[model samples]
Target: MADIQIRKYRDDDAEAVKEVFTLGMSEHIPSSFMHLLKQPPTQMVFMCVFCALLASSKSILLPILAVTLLLAGARQLVSYMFNSYIDTSLKKDLNYITETYLEQKNSCFWVAESDGRVVGTVACLPSENLPECLELKRLSVRRSHRGTGLGKALSQTVADFTRDRGYAAVVLYTSVVQTDAQKLYEHMGYYKIREFVIPELAAKILNFTLIEYRLNVQGD
Candidate 1:
């Protein structure tokens, strides 16, 4: 509820922006691991492994230990997936915020600063897959700053930027594990456009899905 300032991204804010994004993305690992656990394939594999070990070794302790190890491995996989994504993002547009968003035509990035510290970030650029529509990306707020409307304000920053540029709509992709984001976007008038499984082998095997949402600002 403090006075939060939303302004154009600056070069000096690079480290803060990356930190916000990394922390935000890291927060989802637990949920993603749970998602993996809920997958039928994962459940079946765990059950089979546990039962086979129990029958062969005839020791409940060994089977329990094996199952525990498998669970730890699954959690590690989830962490790896999230970490890889964070690393890729840092090496991509985030690595060149000025060039990718600030200097590019019809593209921009903004950071939300509270009490002189960068606490949130959001960016928009012309969508590659949807002509005349801007894609909202890199929306993140520091964990300590959540529940204070920072996320909603960052989202509005992207929407206002898109509308001012005469874009038809704003489109974004959020993974299934990001339930709070799905709610936030829907609450802000973004409608679900479609959902599709990520094409990567690990994602495909785990049934990971990304939901696309669009907010029509043409007539608003």
Candidate 2:
């Protein structure tokens, strides 16, 4: 965390910021894919096949697990449906970070830089879901920088902005795959206000729940 500086977004930072974001988010695909594989549908298929062949030997369990892991790991990187959103956001938002985030009256973006390289990012903008509250958006800390308190630093930037601007509260949304993010938000005094599962077939099978958290800026 040496020489870490959190400051206003700069025009030249778009590429580095996008790189950090893309890489940071890509790290979740492995865990998320594994989560998907552990769902009822995938599990039932794998277990049914394994059970059908159990007569072959008691030593098949390790090989079955290894194969399952390999397939899921491959899908994590090659499944366009599972990862297009992250790539889309990078192409669309990073290209217009200023116009999308920095131009709004009550919105701003901050990047955490260490040793002259951007390592994390966070942004706050007026929430469309709640007009009185600010939405904390795109809080990303590089994988190498986790456990170093970079996440709290980035989140605090948004909280500080909300308080300074007299916003009623701060709100954020994270998916079920991001369990660590849920912990971080809760640790910062955010409370889960809503949860809903995606209606898509695959998501329904995986039980992909979208969670919304809110923190009162004016009180504890």
Give a tens-digit lDDT track for model 1, residues 5-106: 999999999999998989999999999989999999999999999999999999999989999999999988888788888888988888899999988999
- The TM-scores, one per candidate, come to 0.97, 0.84
Runs off by more than 4 Å, candidate 2: 49-79, 200-202
The top-ranked prediction according to lDDT is 1
Residues 1-220 of candidate 2 have per-residue lDDT tens digits of 6679999999999989888887877777777777777778777767766776665566787658766775765475435535676777866677789998889799999999998889999998999879989999889998888999999989988999999999989999898889999999999899999999878665676667789999998985
Native-to-model Cα distance after best TM-score fit, residue 112 in candidate 1, in Å: 0.3
Sliding window of 10 residues with minimal summed lDDT for model 2: 73-82
Q: What are the candidates' C-alpha RMSDs?
A: 1.1, 3.6
